[model samples]
Target: MASSLGKLSGRRVCSVALGSGLPRSRTLGPAGGRICLSALGGTGSAQIRGLGSGSGTGGVGAGGGARRAPWLVAGLAAGLAGVAAAAFHHLAPAEMVPRTEVASSVPDKADDLALRCSSFMTQPVTALSELRARPGDMKTQMELLIMETQSQVCQALAQLDRGATFAVDRWERKEGGGGISCVLQDGHIFEKAGVSVSVVHGVLSEEAEKQMRSRGKKFKTKNGQLPFCAMGVSSVIHPKNPHVPTIHFNYRYFEIEEADGTRQWWFGGGCDLTPTYLNKEDAVHFHQTLKDACDQHDPGFYPKFKKWCDDYFFIKHRGERRGIGGIFFDDLDSPSKEDIFRFVQSCARAFIPSYIPLVKKHCNDPFTPQEKHWQQLRRGRYVEFNLLYDRGTKFGLFTPGSRIESILMSMPLTARWEYMHAPSENSREAEILEVLSHPKDWVH
Candidate 1:
């Protein structure tokens, strides 16, 4: 029931590793090349003309990598090396989609929206390609972005761990091509980092998919295709200090069903800061950056969604919310699909600037084993939210033919639920509890 789960129970696993679609080394390679999923260049935002849950017959295709595969290690190194090499060679990054309305063509608003969504998905793949870290032609660009961004985040933390530098395991792709997954162990920057992505496809008629989807859940397409091609990316980064606190963020793209099964797509993603120990300035800075990104799209969005995030993320089991309030909402159907795509794009475009500085600022902080323990305990609550309440996890599992590995990529390498344990009196950790016990609106 824990959404943050282990490899789908037993039997044939979907993916052994989570993150990056790098080719398996010769020794690791199988009798033949890996199975193929789709030729679509990037994460395709197929317009879902409908949304409905169906009782269709089809199972998720299980693919390569063991959670302990050497390829992910190879890919992470290869990805980082590739990014460095690409930048050194002065390679130009991917072209961003035109956002200003004046610049966009009025002749076709629908197509314009599609173009913008595609551009948003393409840039991450470009970044991964520059890192030389993506899985080759055998894998889709969607798989590549999932893994490459993961390595980028993890490597940032590894740099801060002067001692106990965590070893990054191989990145893995889900069966039937949902997305990639990655995790690190014994890390010094907090404890571990886990990330994942989901890319689904259904080939029903645009009208059929839309009609069914309007019912509120996914409707299965005939022949194992999904009516809605939902792509999601989520990550959890835990710093090694009780003083630093942990953070969770997710970026996603959802398609509206087309009448004949063609997808009508829009993008969505946001980052939030969660500290075990509250630093008002750190919280303010985090929220302000998010506010800036939302402001780029609409002045009304930040306030509404910020309140939405706070309400949505509340953890009922814990009697407290995960972190201070941040932006969150679901089924964000905008009047002009193009406008929604731009909003989601803004969130993706905001990640590097918003989070990298925080990681750089705290990666090198000094902390003790006691602080590390507190971080792990907080992760337990993080795990609870994902498993018990995460709609994404339920969708990944309940959806006919959902990928197993990608669904549970948020699980940490190690976690603990201490028996009636408490941190030292008046310690940096207790200060964190005082904050978590009482949630506040950081942005306002």
Candidate 2:
């Protein structure tokens, strides 16, 4: 557990730290921001001082900041309680586990089923701390939900493919958090597949805070490293059959301690499809499923997130879309935390329905060497997008104690780049390129 906590601390939490240095506590004397760190179990009476306000969009510098007062105790207590609850939930027998001790207490049957699915899987302690602290904690709940979704999606895919199962890797960071990385290589249907779930916490150094400010993050801090917590699930699937398209999904929650000891949090994630061949029906099904999920939560969500997806995944250098867009959203902390968490859950659950059927539809289809070559070429472009422009990749590379293998697990098992290669005019590949060049609405 200690090892996992350390790994989780650095995963996503420290990635945003573009670090400057931690301020010594003395510099944060009573003159700085005043915070009360005495909310949990009446630890003591004292005023804590630190620098920085905790308001930011949350993609960068999301979890680094100081908490100087009693509120600090509240946040820490919540986190510790969450972790304890998670440990108990995992170690205790089901009949012995009290309902009140559960991380979330939603009344919906659907939510219950989702929780059951999650209960069967293991979660890092840090991930549980958020839940114990606040039953409705959006960040922790989303992480749990996403982790379950990853398990279910990968399991379903494995069942369909036959004789393919993901090998799980559990790793930890010395500072404060850990994660599980699941990968399937040279499978019956997929060439490579990676699904990862991480929970991390860490402090952002002064330099990191300044860098975040430059990037438009809104926060103020006095001295000492800012504290942060991040959790999420990320995955990419590459099929063996060229006819089958590639898919990617990422869902995450982030939180940071404010100078006032208040916690600032947000949710971000999306799913997109990349096909070697464009099938109008497949594209329609994928987009429609995502739309349905969003509609169930907010009718406006689909359109907004759809546009964000198109804009975010674009390969600016090549002037092409990464794939037919699905839905992407970030910095979301509105319409109530519970609602947004449910919304994220809906999106996470939508993945299998949106993608698996397509895989089943095309997995056995015959493909010639020429088509396979095209697929590899397309994969090369996928690599380009990830290594160059993907924010998650950049952050992972920068994060402390990052496992390079897991970070690069999204890379294709095999990809080929050709100099000045172009598909034949009016051909199937060319048609796909045209659509990518100008993303179209598969569902409106």
Best by the TM-score measure: 2
In model 1, the Cα lDDT at residue 294 comes to 89
- lDDT of each structure? 0.48, 0.63
lDDT per residue, candidate 1, 1-444, as tens digits?
Answer: 122112212111112222112223212113433212122222212111000011211111122111111112211222211211112232112212222331121224654332332322122222232224433321233334443444455445434432222222222223322333444433334344555444444443344344446647554344545544455567766554455546667766556454466655544455666776667887877788888988988888888888677666668967767677567756666766556655765665566666667666655455566666666787787788778776556655554454454455556655679888777889877776666667566667
Q: What is the C-alpha RMSD of each candidate to the true structure, in Å?
A: 14.5, 17.3
- Tell me how candidate 2 scores on lDDT: 0.63
lDDT of 1: 0.48
CA deviation > 4 Å runs, candidate 2: 1-134, 205-215
Give the CA lDDT, 0 to 100, for residue 348 in model 1: 53
Q: Which candidate has the top score in lDDT?
A: 2
